[model samples]
Target: MSKVILITGGSSGIGKSVGNFLTKKGYTVFGTSRFPEKYPQSNFPIIRMDVTKPNSVTEAVASVIEKAGRLDVLINNAGVGITGPIEELPDSEIQKNFETNFFGPIRVIKAVLPVMREQQAGLIINVTSIAGYMGLPYRGIYSASKGALELLTEAFRMEISNFNIAMTNVAPGDFATNIASGRYHAPVLENSPYKQAYGNTLKLMDTHVNQGKDPLEMAKAIYKIINTPKPKVHYKVGEFMQKFSVVLKRVLPDKVYEKLLMNHYKL
Candidate 1:
């Protein structure tokens, strides 16, 4: 029997690519997004959902259960990004980001755990980012969100292993996606506290994301991990640069790492 996989934030970017790829591989793919009506009704069905909304998550899961009877895997790929000096961003902006990036995945997991626990088998893949491990300038909020996600996944992995559930966290480096352009940006001009502190740094980081790894490559990496017999707890996907970054983060002193990031982003 074909396995059933559900993906969140499947309307575009890596989520959409994974949905398309998995469906091609014969998995019964059910993707969720707030704008399901915009996604064509096809083999990879798109269901209406907002990760930050509990009701939406519940409804999406219920719909998939009714149709598929069982869900074999879940890809928690739905997330949002916000960039700027932490102090400069409005309190609401930070909360909004955490709500979408962190709590969003939690919501989906809660809605899916019951079925998986009962079946005593399932897999969850969290689409985290390198920023989850190494912090970046003007990205304190983004880092915080993913960092929390990484820790949450760890706790979840430990808690659910006994239930025969597997969890994998994919930490991809910079990818060329709409996430950079689509991020929530707050104006830096008006009397913001950290306007001057983050002005140039934000610009440089934005430029880097504008030209990064291809999103399709990320999608392929995700597909491989999903099909693994015993999926690992974490997978890092990126080019040579990303590997080097990880190494430097571990070997270099704190000041040295900071200097490298400062030079990379021209901070």
Candidate 2:
């Protein structure tokens, strides 16, 4: 039987691309969306899921297992982007971002762990972001949320390794997606000190995203990860410079790295 794969946020963007690619490769793929009925018809199935809600997550995973009898892969790709100066972002907004970007994966992972443990073999891929590696101006909360998820994936991998389960954190750079349009912009109060800086940085960030790499490239990387035995714990998918920047941050002097980041974002 073909492998059964479940991808969150599969209605669009990177998750959708990955689901379609895997389906073409003969895998039984189910993509999750809060509103599955709204998406255009496709070969793979759409499962209703809202990762933030525990019951929703549980039901979605159960539905997949009921139909497929087994789940070989789980891709935690549902995430949201929030932008603005750290101080200007309201507490509730930050919580909402974390709910979707960090805790959402946690909920899904928890829901699927039991079945995967019983099977004694499964692959879990958490889709993170390059921004997680370094704090980005006007996007600190989003970066922090992804960073938290990355750390959790790293720690969870070690715990689950003995069960014959594999986990990988895939940190992708900017991709040409509708994420920018959906991003929550923190309200900048009139006369807020960071308003101008936030505007300039946000503009630069949007430009970078508009010119970002294609989502298909990320899907290809994910396809390879699914096929490979003993895939690495972490995969960085994006332009050479963006991937290299992660390495540079590790080796470069603190001040130098900070300056480079500031210049890149025009902060």
Off by over 4 Å in 1: 41-43, 190-197
Q: Which digits, one per residue and each the tens of the lDDT, describe model 2 over residues 1-267?
A: 899999999988899889888999999999999999988696689989999899999999999999989999999999999998888788999999999999999999999999999999999999999999988778899999999999999899998889898999999998998899889987666798987788888788889899999999999999999989998978999999999999999999999999998888777
lDDT of 1 by residue, 182-236 (tens): 7887677767666675777767667767788887888788788877889887888
TM-score of each: 0.94, 0.98
RMSD of each: 1.7, 1.0
Whole-structure CA lDDT of model 2:
0.92
Candidate 2 residue-wise lDDT at 265: 74
Candidate 2, poorest ten consecutive residues by summed lDDT: 186-195
Model 2, 56: alpha-carbon shift in Å?
Answer: 0.2
Candidate 1 lands at a TM-score of 0.94
RMSD of 2: 1.0
